[model samples]
Target: MTIPKDKMLEMLHFLMLSRRFEEALTDLCRIEGKIPGMMILCTGQEAVGVGMVAALRPEDVIITNHRSHAHLLTKGADPKVLMAEIYGKRTGCNKGKSGTLHLALPEIGAPCTSTVVGAGPPIAVGRAFAQQYRNEPGITVCFVGDGATGEGSFHEALNLASLWRLPVIFVCENNRYAGAQRQEEHTRIENIADRAAGYRMPGVVVDGNDAMSVYTTALDARARAAAGEGPTLIECKTYRWRGHGESDPQLYQPKEEIAAWRALCPVARMRDAVRARGLISAEDLKAMEARVETLVQEAIRFAEESPYPEPHEALEDVYA
Candidate 1:
């Protein structure tokens, strides 16, 4: 399916906005100490978030790991709410009860955030099973890191998702590292997508830095899921420009590697791609950036002014 130039530009702007927000958050975490001592960043993976979100309906669900601010923003969740939540404000999503590590926006079907590495896939598979059994058209998308795939639950979830043909898409943001360990050090497979063959499912690897490519691939996966073709495993070859978490020193990755990946920034690439079509002007791109900046500033102001959760509210929502 061909996307109109305008829509492509819009998607590019969204990717840019998500990237900007994440970049701002990294700064916020450092100077402002807004985030906890440790925070994982999704810096260079804007295309995966923007592209994947573009392919989903509002009612379709997304389940992701701790590094999900970009996904949340792409799904149209309020940045104010996100900032507030990060600040543990009562006005934030989940009443600010959950931190950056555990966000949930059921209104947009992003049920929850998992900080437990590979935990999200099974939860997403469960949601997929429920949707399929109820004959609902919605699909669940689960994200895991290259490191998470090493866990036992990753294989277990893959087996279940395939055996039942659950309407879910398993997306592995293979940034080539699980914390500080390079992916090659932990696995022998050339491509993470190749693992899908064991489950008898289709797996595709795409340039995760290309927004259109990621969107097209995710759209196809969702369509296949809706048509009862089960799940698809998508390995998005991307990189995170930041350390694994805010507290991490990141001495393992070479400086040259970071420089090389930074050159592939998804938002910048998408902007260039859209401009090359001659459908968008330089002024239009500037306007989009200005708007995103204003929105982010407002989000910061709102989060800064928002009230923290009441001291007595800690007893709530613990029934699990």
Candidate 2:
């Protein structure tokens, strides 16, 4: 499963972009107070989003959890529009109606995002069922946190997806924490993927920090689903470098653990791997970083310059 150098570079670029974008949002919230809503930064888990989404076609749909900035960016959603949405601007992807946690970009195949725990899997199952009924070849991807495994909806959705042989990939971004509680304290199972056996589907755990590893695993899962072999549960063992959200005190996570995971920074790891392979030069890496910085600045500017939605327009999109 040797990924091409060009594709690896692209992954690296997206990883950097996601990280920088989150950082920009954090700065806005903490320093400028420009962003109006809560944010969950995927600082360390960029690899999982970049790797998995890169393997999918443009038509493939992705359903995401609350921590969705990485997923949306990887799915080709406009960063400026996302930033505007965070700022509650009218030019946002959802017309500034839904903020960070409830982004909806249908044009890019990321129809909607949910802030509720474990709610995305069932929705993903419904989307996959519709595709199956319509004889559509597109697949659905449901991104869930490790904590989602404990939810009844998660198990029920898996059961139904397996029963119908739905073309949905259940991706558990196991960051080892469900909100403030650690995984060991909440769940009896060692690996979340182990539960896949109960549903009669293939389950595999991959190094979520390694982008290429996740990419290859996603390729195999996509192949299996395309062949009607049923849904696959992929548990990506990764960690979040930031708190659960912007305002969380993060009292539960130890400083040592945070430092250790920071040492395993996925962006730096990919950059080193690419440079060591001579696929990209030091100059190339620097240039890429410069470009990402410029892009992040542009997104910030776009969000700031964008106008807020008119008060009268809120009633226009409402169905009730």
Candidate 3:
């Protein structure tokens, strides 16, 4: 499916915004020492986030793993709220309690997120079940890392989703590495989507770095789900630009491989593509960057002024 020029430009703009936000976060972590370290960035995976969000309605649900800033931004989340959350301010989306792992904005269908690997799939299945039972038209799109597929919950969620034909789209960001381990050291399957056959559903593999490809595949999967078709396993061939998470001394991979992945940076490619297509002028990109910078600055101010959680409130949310 060819996206209109305007929509493509919009996605490109959003992708650039997300990249700038991540960069700001990294700078904050390094310069201000606000966060302990840099986040595992989705630098080469912007297309997946952009494309998938394009296929979704405002009311449609989305759940994802720890690497989900792009998802939040694409869903129209305020940059100020996100930075506030990362800063652990009471005015954040989750009252500054969720941090990087658990951010949610129910109004925009971002219910919550999980830092624990593979937890999103089951939750997505549960959300799908609820929507289906309520006769709602919304579908759930879940993002998982390649490492997540090794978890038992991944299989369990897929099985249950297939059994009930839940409106859940399982998007696997197979960056070929899980934390410090390479995919070669993990499962033996040549393709993660191949496993979907066991559930009797469609298995799709797409270039995750290509925004149009991701959007098209996600649109197809979502259409199938809405039509009562079974779940789909979409393995996105992408790469990570940073270490797994903050404080990861990445020794498991080689510098050459990292450099190689850098060549396929999603945001950079999209910007070039849009320019080549004459969809956006360079000045337009500059204007968008200025807008994103303003929002980021406002976010920092908001986080600084916002209150922190009280001493006793932490225990209140904890279940025994």
lDDT of each: 0.87, 0.91, 0.84
What are the models' TM-scores? 0.96, 0.98, 0.94
Query: Between which residue pairs do clashes occur in model 2?
Result: none
Q: In model 2, how large is the Cα lDDT of residue 98?
A: 92
Q: Where does candidate 1 have its weakest 10-residue lDDT segment?
A: 31-40
Query: Compared with the true structure, what per-residue lDDT tens digits does model 3 show for residues 1-320?
Result: 56789778878878888888888776677656575323666766778888888888876899977888998889888888888888887778887678867888887898878878999999999999998999888899999999999999999999999999998899999988898888989989979999899888788999998887898888899999888886899999988877786467667768898898889888888888888888878888788778878877888888878888787877766777
RMSD of 2: 1.0
TM-score pick, better of 1 and 2 = 2
Candidate No. with top TM-score: 2
Report the alpha-carbon TM-score of model 2 versus the true structure: 0.98
After superposing candidate 3, which stretches have Cα over 4 Å from the reference?
A: 36-38, 315-320
Question: Could you give the candidate ranking by lDDT, starting with the highest?
Answer: 2, 1, 3
- Whose TM-score is higher: candidate 1's or candidate 3's? 1
